[model samples]
Target: MKHQTSQLEFSRPLQVDRVPRLGSVEKLSAEPKELKALAKRMKLPALHALSAELRATPWRGGGLKVEGHLTADIEQVSVISLEAFRETVSLPVSRYFLPAGAVNDNDQEDDADPISNGWVDLGEVVAEILALDLDPYPRKPGEAFEEHVEIEAEPKPESPFAVLARRKGD
Candidate 1:
């Protein structure tokens, strides 16, 4: 009888995140009060949608910029730009071997699912959304500002080991 063996290699395609960008810039003609109200309604949903889309993407590092200009008629239109790092997080391929006992009597074979076993979590995504010239168009920009505010806790006192190490003549 003759014996033969086969080898299998697994590769997973890398998924890239799509960053949002400003498509066009235009001006609006309305009163300051009316434009403020309109801008608020228009930008809030778009910002939220962009945030959700960013959360869904595989890549987590990027920054967003929003710029707005007011026209003589007191109309406001904003442009949003996004820049992403070209680097990618590459995942290594894994190899597996099957034992003789694991093979079926009918010449069947069992293979392990690579993804199911080797899943890894990179980390949570952090993004900074900034709006330019916000002093004039305060209403719309401030709506989403509170969500991004970070309240950091004060540092705790060092332990005895740290304190002793810092002491002179250790």
Candidate 2:
């Protein structure tokens, strides 16, 4: 397949097959517009900056080893305070992207990540990584969380032994 970058503002598609035998390294940064769109897609308050430095090393068998770090400044609502706060997110990424169906049964491989159509969309991958790394229940600095415990109103029912005792007394 002839690999090509998409027209989207945040597109970071890499043509793995086109890389020279020596391998390739890439640095990607998202513009303000792209960050805004990403924030909207991820349901965050705001996304100030998004950048990554990635290295792609190809093996003789067409498998690629991808290593990178993604950094971003984002604004999100704190679950504890219910207020917006800015925080920096940094994630180190590493994965193996094998060519489709390249693994043999005896190889005992993990195919969680794979190259598709000779291309890898670094932007999408970074976004997903950031989302996965985010705190599902974020809390602001110094925000206290108080868990409310409900107490049942009814008293405990009498046990069989207690009923038998009452009958014997009567």
| Each model's backbone clash number | 0, 0
Model 1 segments more than 4 A misplaced: 1-147, 168-170
Which candidate wins on TM-score?
2
Q: Per-residue alpha-carbon lDDT of model 2 for 62-170, expressed as tens digits?
A: 7777788999998989997799999998899886777767755566656446678888787777887887888878888788768888887899888999999999999
Which 10 residues in a row give candidate 2 its minimum summed lDDT?
A: 103-112
What is candidate 1's CA lDDT for residue 69?
24
Candidate 2, residue 62: how far the Cα is off, in Å: 1.6
Residue-level lDDT tens digits of model 1 in 52-127: 1112221112222112322212123322222211111112222222223433446443342122221211111111
Clash number for model 1?
A: 0
Q: Estimate each model's TM-score.
A: 0.14, 0.82
* C-alpha positional error of residue 26 in candidate 2 after TM-score superposition, expressed in Å: 1.1
CA lDDT, every model vs. true structure: 0.26, 0.81
